[model samples]
Target: MNPSRRGLILGAGAASLAGPTLAQTDGLVLNGRFVQGGFAMGRAAPRAIVFVNGEALTTASAAGLFVVGFDRDAPPYVDIEVHAGNSVGGRVARRTLTVAPGSFPSTRINGLPQSTVEPSDPALLARIQQEIALKTEGFASRADADDFRSGFAWPLDAYRVTSRWGSQRVLNGTPARPHYGIDLAAPAGSPIRAPADGIVTFARPGMHFEGGLTLIDHGQGLITAYLHQSRIEVLPTQRVARGTIIGRVGATGRATGPHLCWRMKWRDRNCDPSLLIGQNAPENS
Candidate 1:
């Protein structure tokens, strides 16, 4: 792939950081936030092959659109390469991107039960492990559609942000894993809508940590999860349109109060769903 043929397309929002060096190439273009925990949308020739840092992505669509995600702890640089046409004699395009590191703050949360912080019951731990395995299968979904092309909207019509993503969480005086979801504080029974078109991959109630959880696959391994719901209206394998009500918020699970833990994953990378709100990938030029 030639380095001179790569391009990036950025929209008009905070998600569109100004760092990508767009080239004069015409066939392949990518657009999105060039920061850690952000995602990018791209378009290439139909059936084109895309590789990020030498790993093959889940193949391009018939329309040539694709999406790439930067992990929360992603390195400062990324390399994107596209191969159009057949491998024997195809046009190659490449771009070395600069990814900005995220600035995460420490979040202290107290007044939690001791068992939740440090579980000692063997049976409870085993159940937690089983739940983790089920969630893993949900995150591994990679439907071959660019459903994200419709862009994203806020899941809740009215809510207050209680916790932002990528915060170092300290629960009850003990440091824990970094929080990866944006906590939306809303009244119990407040409806949560689908941010984009997707297929429901997992929906279950009464998990240990997450009392109620619903995961939606927004195509190409980009999945969004809703946690601590009071009522789940959808089921696994169901197709939901954007703005459809999937569930209602609640204070179930380990939460301190009524809220919705909104999380997103693009393949193995955890990205900030807030960045994609009101942002759509630029159309092919």
Candidate 2:
């Protein structure tokens, strides 16, 4: 239940969760990895209010289950503040999270559809904006499901990691957003399983950018998305367990070949899917 009290830590990356007791600072317990593009789960006194990154936007569960997320380009240090006890001016157990950097490699590809790489058509631009809004609304709500606490798995049985998180990408020699998801190379129509327990938030087919896309809510602001699928077997609001076949991999949307693009998002920040699996994935992943 209480992750911090139990001293349980998740995420296989370049960061470690501090022990249960701060000792020199206070009696707060925190767990979870600290690498860029990942998340950390922290627990404290039930009555304590937690502030992350100097913002009061983070909400702790009634059991004091608060989660912090780092983006792909997250800063080297993050500030965390905990207001413990009932005292008016409680101790500011503010801690700066030392984030471990993730090495990224640059990739270049030429001879792609210019419109697909960079939408120049007015109608297509409107569609792209609309799709982005729709995708954003997909995971806007937070849930109480504890599936993410368990961990994740590879959607495919075995595959090569052709791309990694935050890798530089140049489409037709024009720079674009760094890749944010891991690419699992598989044949078209290959089964894609759910990596962890979650509820399907949105499943749409043939969008302009992501093609067949599905968003699974794993609770506590933890979510994962399946992009560029040939087929989606799950529907919105459906509950799925780890290893369940949720879709079929394929070359859809703007992709170059058949593969599954798996992405993770914690609250509003992006996270590397590999970190949450509790094991070190291949370097290309």
Candidate 3:
């Protein structure tokens, strides 16, 4: 890797992936959290084609920048490849990385309305399905901008973490899917800010599970979602900069208390939002 280029740094509390120190290549530099539910930013020769597991996930930016993410249930090892130049004097670099599994704890929450935990009403179930479909469209937004290069910040000035990413959740004595978002406990109506520059792809004031849901596309399939909001201030196609107030925290959805469920996604892969705090995007040499 080039000595002048820098990659993202994870927060102090983020779990670091354990692995052997693999040799770095000068042709392509990569860095960031490498564990399951983590993220990584990369830099390669300008116009170079990058691939993960033989599939071209993304092409490098004009400045040779790009990003990738690991899902919550990502496998133990990942394969990366970069190809540059043509048939004459071409350059290729390959790297195999060992990723660490997420250490999630079992969490049990009682006293919630049984309907919220496992809705039995056919009408309510249909509404939930519609809401999920809307969110799916929001996650599909992919703008050709580099707004993520500005990096991310905490959405709230101060809050307590009530639930972490990838936690095994048991609600109302029924085991549920692992939580994919970080739940920040804040007073109702607390201001929520945009974590990075991005264009709003979806914003609705009402949803069965995610009240006042909102999603922002930070370019190249990197999207962030805010759930259980008391108020939604932005609209679809709106552009917002970091620290811009976008909404207010609340318990309007299935939540038992006032809080914000913050989530991040790189394409379809879910990632840890807390890991991006205070991290800067990678730059070319």
lDDT of 1 by residue, 245-275 (tens): 9999998788999999999999988998887
What TM-score, computed on C-alpha atoms, does each candidate reach? 0.91, 0.83, 0.88
Candidate 3 or 2, higher TM-score: 3
Residue-pair clashes per prediction, in order, are 2, 0, 0
- What is the clash tally of candidate 3? 0
What TM-score should be assigned to candidate 3?
Answer: 0.88
Candidate 3 on 8-97: residue-level lDDT in tens? 332232223432122343566666667788766677776667677778776666676667888889887777777775211358866665
Q: Could you tell me how far off, in angstroms, the CA of residue 190 lies in candidate 3 after the best superposition?
A: 0.7
lDDT-superior candidate, 1 or 2 = 1
Query: lDDT per prediction?
Result: 0.83, 0.74, 0.79
Number of the top-ranking candidate, with TM-score as the measure = 1
Of 1 and 3, the candidate ranking higher by lDDT: 1
Q: Determine the C-alpha RMSD for candidate 2 after optimal superposition of all C-alphas.
A: 6.6
Q: Model 2: per-residue lDDT, tens digit, 80-102?
A: 77776633377656566666676
Question: Candidate 1, which segments miss by more than 4 Å at Cα?
Answer: 1-16, 19-23, 86-89
